[model samples]
Target: MLKHPKNAVMVLARCFSDLDRRLLLLILIPPLSLIVFFSLSSLSPVRSFILGRTILHPQQAVMLNSTDSQQSDVVFAPSSWKDELDRSRIAVCLVGGARRFELTGPSIVEKILLEYPNSDLFLNSPMDSNAFKFSLLNSAPRLAAVRIFRPKPMPESELQLRVLTAHNSPNGIQGLLQYFNLVEGCLTLIQQYQKQNNFTYDWIVRTRVDGYWNAPLDPKFFVPGKYLVPPGTNYGGLNDRLGIGDLNTSTVALSRLSLLPQLDAAGFHQLNSEASFKAQLTTRKVTPVLKRLPFCIVTDRKYDFPPVRFGVPVAAISSPGPLSGVKCRPCKPVCQGPCVGDVMEGLNKGWGWTDWANGTLELCNAHGDFDEGWEKMFDKVAGKKLSSERKRVWKLTVEKCIANFNKMRNRTGIWDTPPVDEICKTGITSGPK
Candidate 1:
């Protein structure tokens, strides 16, 4: 139907006299189709953008269908996946105070650190009486850095004041700044490790010290080009509790303090931590993947029972949870089934919301202190292994705590904390007679 062969080739190439015209013609021509197919097949498949710092195309995202509850349960494990992870370099950056580390630390060691024994652990936490509890990290497979610095007032810049809001933060903007400092400080440690080793890490896991994991972090959550976060508990932005990403994307995620100027330039104002987290990722063109992860934030803070539209829902530790980093505590459940449905339906999905479908969630009436005998409740829910860890911390003496800290310090690549004697004696004292 073409006037000439050149014209036909032009139509396929969208131009004439091009170097690729012959190649295009070969691909388009029916006679060469089989030959072209075989040739291309042998040329190796085009690699995905995931393994590098390139922006991922939307079509490449592997996300659970938001409406399909069962999609979250489907995990495809290639035989070589775990072996591949073992070969890859990973950094696990833990931040925040070890307030309830006695309860949460063991779960973290078992579920995350041991799950991928190759990962190097880095902790950036403020030194306090509870910090001695971090001696529990003696169980970690590999120690990269431990910085238990004493807290000080972080200087708040004009840009930071403009970009961040004190709306929901307990200690206002200063608290947010302190938190940002902790996260960014951990990033500095990771970068320094890579610089000293002359090699970059393949992945970085940034998590809170207070988080408790009910199950192992599955390999499926590691999508190469995208930053992974637990779905829900996003108060006007992304969930900031736990994050997983490749080095490039994680660098942006962990630059919580350094990126405020960029956020200010972008006209983002009065953003909460979660909202700011989402903004930073969007500003850098880093795609965020939301998956239902099996972890929860163990907190002593109480929330109103039968939460309203914008109120927080505190979950009971006994719930069948991939709680997705929602606030939870060891307590007797006060709501389930239809009751949960009623409460969750009334809450705003954009704020203080988490997946409660299919009996996966149970609510706790957290208006009061932790239920009497919560230690026993925690032990029962945490099983034999983690329960032993709890008991160990409960009965820990200054002498034993110092011994554990010294053991951990010996294994650590960088020890930035105070002396083990000071750390242990500052916290542990003789128990009441």
Candidate 2:
């Protein structure tokens, strides 16, 4: 064994070289593996976990990286967009029944109207028991017009009959016509305001009276050339719940009634409201930009649980959601975690589907009216200020309501509603309840 000392030295050198190679491999593998793993996570249909949050989709990854994501749920418009909103004249068109205005109004004022303080608010709603609750908006920064009309039957023309269908509408074709009238009425109000003020609005934000906003409206939605709408709840068409656009695009989008003839000419038929909305826009060459927004339509309507493929899925109001104009109600969540995943997986993505990933959605039973003491649930979720507003409305009296309406009238550019007494008396009595 001691015969060849030089050979032994060469063998020892080879072993040392092999040891160095092994050490280098050890040093490189972990970081390289991490690089590969992260790269793979960026691909589609793959979920990436970062900071304990799941990046469920490619766009979500972009969203997380963008300045749009914030620690607080309240999302602000980019500084540039904020500047644009400040300089630009914005007309906020609010339509729909004031079913739960007491619960929803403060959020709208705080999140949207106040977010863009320069924007003018125009409301076109049918007068109902809840109409008096709209006095909550007296606190709005800018008031343009308010129209609380007694809804009447809209004449369905031949073209409307040809183009629209009554399939899923609870009120049939008449319902659609009334909705179209409400939307167009707001547009008319805006136009009249412009003529009176001698200045045209640069933007219009069309939303519903019953939309409860969980966060501030993102300013990125104000796309100049495109009409921005929420994603999902599209029944064979685009989501028509909320819309934001520049003057030209908004004109086309808001002319829901007047655009029927054009849609008919383009060979679109048997359309529901959402479908008709999509048809009108596409026929007019206005591109719809689908963006997830931080508001939901507050509804008292009940729907099936664990929704079937085409059935509507009712979301819980407390869900950490952008909701994107989906129907939601205040209730105890009946489903969460994997239960939600399983339920949402069964629904049609083109129908009532909404983003439920990363615990963003929770389901409400919605098989009946709001759960007992849902008010407490709402207060907890909405926090103190909004909860106080809700309490104020609950205890509102005719005199106070009238005073609130008068205050709103004083600030408003045009007030086309009935006498303040009539409006207040309809919803509230002589004294606090």
TM-score of 2: 0.81
Every candidate's lDDT: 0.86, 0.85
| Each candidate's clash count | 0, 0
Model 2 segments more than 4 A misplaced: 1-77, 430-433
Residue 33 lDDT, candidate 2, scale 0-100: 96
lDDT of candidate 1 over 76-184, digit per residue (tens): 3333566677789999999999889988999999999999999999999999888888989999999999999989998888888899999989999999999999999
Clash pairs (backbone) in predicted model 1: none
Query: Across residues 242-309, which tens digit of lDDT does each residue of candidate 2 receive?
Result: 99988999999999998898888899999999999999898888888777899998888888776788
